[model samples]
Target: MTTKENNYTSLEVGTFESLLSRNYKGIEGKFFIGNELGLSGCEVSLNRLPAGKAVPFVHAHKKNEELYIITGGNGTFFVDGVEFNVQEGSLVRVAPAGARAYKAGDKDLYFICIQAQAGSLTQATHEDGIILNTKASWMNGKK
Candidate 1:
């Protein structure tokens, strides 16, 4: 189910298998969903690279740092000429100027990449959240 309300947007991207089946032209297994959600602060991409494939080139951010959450399979991440072996549980942070690239391993690799301005967060959820007196209607067990 997908919801588009005044305060937020919800997208049902389906299962991991659905995500991997998409091929844009000749490129397979990559989806950029940030614009679909009208994102303003960051860009998010869901990627599933086939075994042995790598991102075509290395890249670096001018102001944004990337956080890659590895959700499945294996890969080697290159940063500044250094290599780091990554897998299902790996979480990687690449600083704004760190040159980076990735290559998938023997099995398909799945990851979510989130990019936002480096050092730009002034407050986290705990610090920015407001305790509302109103109760959530969903709490009535009707999601």
Candidate 2:
């Protein structure tokens, strides 16, 4: 069944676009599931990096955490000065305070980045007894 509010056609059909802001260098991105999807607790995006290029700089978040899932090619991810090689199926998690950056391999690299604020989901849904109709808001265009 399809729900206009939340049911998206498919990631395969999702258009890959340049990252919204050009402030950063060496990366292109498309936001697949975001506020448009009625998501408040988390957001997802597809990131692509060309060979020999890397994210412009290392950065850390103040409230949100990020998880990166490598989908194609390979790359080196640096978190808080530590490096890790990532490839297809590799998953990396970075906490709010963990500085991070990455470089694409010889070939282009593609990955999915999922981000959410720490404790926001549980606090809003369970602890606060606020039932969020995340899907419905997408169709209605309001939350």
Candidate 3:
């Protein structure tokens, strides 16, 4: 029988070089992390919003819950029409059905958003019939 030696991978540690600009309608800013890291069972992103700009729309997930960790600047987070002030060190959690959005204040807003389906992380690994596929090029703009 053959055995695997390690189950970890390393990604570049800096954020400045990884930030990519993204815009939709009137919203605009940058994001630092994405699926390019091959993470499993969860999606993580570090987002930056320029002062006075907000996310394009309020959105909710059907099966996934999200946690936002505010790391810099200040912002107003709207969840179902209620406003909450968020700043560095603030952590917010939104359920799958809660609508949410945010607007940045005078300083640039930086936050990390992590989403995952409830209870999915506790499931068994490959030994329970799960299968891991080879890394695909879809996210890299390849055909």
RMSD of 1: 2.5
All models, RMSD in angstroms: 2.5, 8.3, 10.9
Cα displacement (angstroms), candidate 2, residue 53, comes to 1.3
Q: What is the Å distance of residue 65 in model 1 from its true position?
A: 0.6
Which residue runs does candidate 2 get wrong by more than 4 Å? 1-3, 6-27, 30-32, 121-143
Best by TM-score: 1
Q: State how far residue 111 of model 2 sits from its true place (Å).
A: 0.6
TM-score for candidate 1:
0.87
Ranking by TM-score: 1, 3, 2
Q: In candidate 3, which residue pairs get closer than 3 Å at backbone N, Cα or C atoms, i.e. clash?
A: none
Model 3 CA RMSD to the hidden true structure, in angstroms: 10.9
lDDT-best of 1 and 3? 1
Candidate 3: regions farther than 4 A off: 1-6, 16-27, 30-34, 121-143
Better of 1 and 2 by TM-score: 1
Q: Write the per-residue lDDT of candidate 3 for residues 1-143, one digit (tens) a residue.
A: 22223785556545632343554343454443444566777888777787788877899999989999988888899999999899999999999999999998987788888998976765565656855575667856676
Best by lDDT, which number? 1
TM-score for each of the candidates:
0.87, 0.67, 0.71
lDDT by residue for model 1 over 1-143, one digit each (tens)? Answer: 66889999999988665776776555688888888898989999888988899988899989999999999999999999999899999999999999999999998899999999999899999999999778788776687
